[model samples]
Target: MSILASSFHEGPLLDKYNNLLISHERYRAMFDNIPLAYMSMNENAAIIDFNNAFSELTGYSCEEVYMKPFSFFLYDKKDIEYHVNVTFPRFKRNGFARNQPWKLKHKSGREIYVIVHGNVRYDTDGRFIQTHCLIVDVTEQRLAREECQRAESKAQLILDVISERVTFHDREHHVLWANKNARSNAAPEC
Candidate 1:
């Protein structure tokens, strides 16, 4: 007999129990070790559990966040209002929210931009249980985009100030942008 068969004379009952234990362990390992931040909140939106990555991302210990409202970390009043009025209601209705961006306040008072995915959980009886959320820190990505936009705006300003007529066109031969001189010098379409 195989070791598992020999060890468990209780047959399928013990096998099922063992399988459940193994599955639970695997899920716990994944939940704790995944690089992205993960958290679960109670039906009232209070934090119930979170992973080490979440603690590190928000700079708050698990103890500090536990039992606190999820909105406690929102950086702005308007954001809090939006979450309460818009996001939560939509999540409740749809049971899932994907890749929605929000700003959270880090413990050190820095704003952390994150893209969040949330799913509402229900009991076997269809009663609401809690919400599970995955948070990906996108602060660096957002800042980089802002910097690029600023650079483009500065370049456009330089182009506009020059005396030369400059126009930018897409591959389809449609004008995307034109410097001030180019716009002023262009003939009216017949």
Candidate 2:
């Protein structure tokens, strides 16, 4: 006859409520144990929490980063503004930001390139309380792109020199890609 007893009698609703709680717990566990670097920060940009992958990538223990200002590791002043003013505000307003590249300096003073995905969490009143992020180191990808550009430039130079038509075929039937003078002298028939 009591209200509490009546609620328990609502078996279908109780089952749904229990299922929702279980689903939420499973989601939280997955978020916390994800393989990539995951983190959350307060509105002041202080690191509130991070996962195991974060510690592994930055070489900092969880205890060391907790409550620390996220920008403390930013060696470049430009990066501080870029993250705080531009990236953070937009992310906080939009609820999500993705693949923003950062040149992050570690505790050991090594710089690493990382692409970050972030989301802002709001309290019941719809006020922003925390920002969560997932990070992936992209230094190798950036380096590989730069190296490919350099090699392409070198190959272009070789092609430009070969266009001069001054070189000739070698005795082994391979084209001698040399200076214009050598090609002109060797292949006078052309």
Candidate 3:
């Protein structure tokens, strides 16, 4: 009877241990399999750990980036300054920063635009431990936005050079935009 009771107690403990191990594995798999680039850095901003997505985005292997400062990957000095002076302070104070624009230097020597989200972690004693980051590549999106803006500016210039008055109105009949000639040729109100 005593032996049977001891075995039953051990079974539940073993099952609980196995469940803990499975949970850890699941967490690690999810971290690695996430589509966006993910990285963890030490308090000094040195690269400590990174997921496969980060390796793919930067075209850099873990060996190449291990223990390197985050600024080592930056494409511009101004960006480094911004990170140090603005982003870092805000992140430290608030424990998080969202959608911060960054330009990183790729292994192929090209600049890649990214929006970074970062969260700081603290130890049980409330001491800063590390920062975890998620990075979304925005190079294509930024380029598309710039192209659209340039096209709009060029169309506006064409309208300004024309002799005819051109006015753009919204559905509410409010003037959105008017060419220079249209603005100048407007009649005085009755």
Q: Which candidate is the best by TM-score?
A: 1
Give model 1's TM-score versus the native structure: 0.87
Residue clash pairs of candidate 1: none
- The per-residue C-alpha lDDT of model 3 at residue 19 equals 91
Tens digit per residue, CA lDDT, model 3, 1-190: 6986677568887688789999999998998888999988887788899998898888898798888888888999998888777877778778998988889999999989999999999889888898989999999998999999999999999999999999999999988999999999888879
What's the lDDT for residue 5 in model 1? 73
- As for lDDT, the candidate ahead, 1 or 3, is 1
TM-score of decoy 2:
0.67
Q: Model 1, 98-130: lDDT tens per residue?
A: 999889999999999999998999889877788
Error of 2 at 140 (Å): 1.5
* Shift in Å, residue 93, candidate 3: 2.7
Local accuracy of candidate 2 as per-residue lDDT tens digits, 123-165:
9999999998999988789999999999977875676566554
The segments of candidate 2 whose C-alpha lies over 4 angstroms from its true place after superposition are: 1-33, 165-190
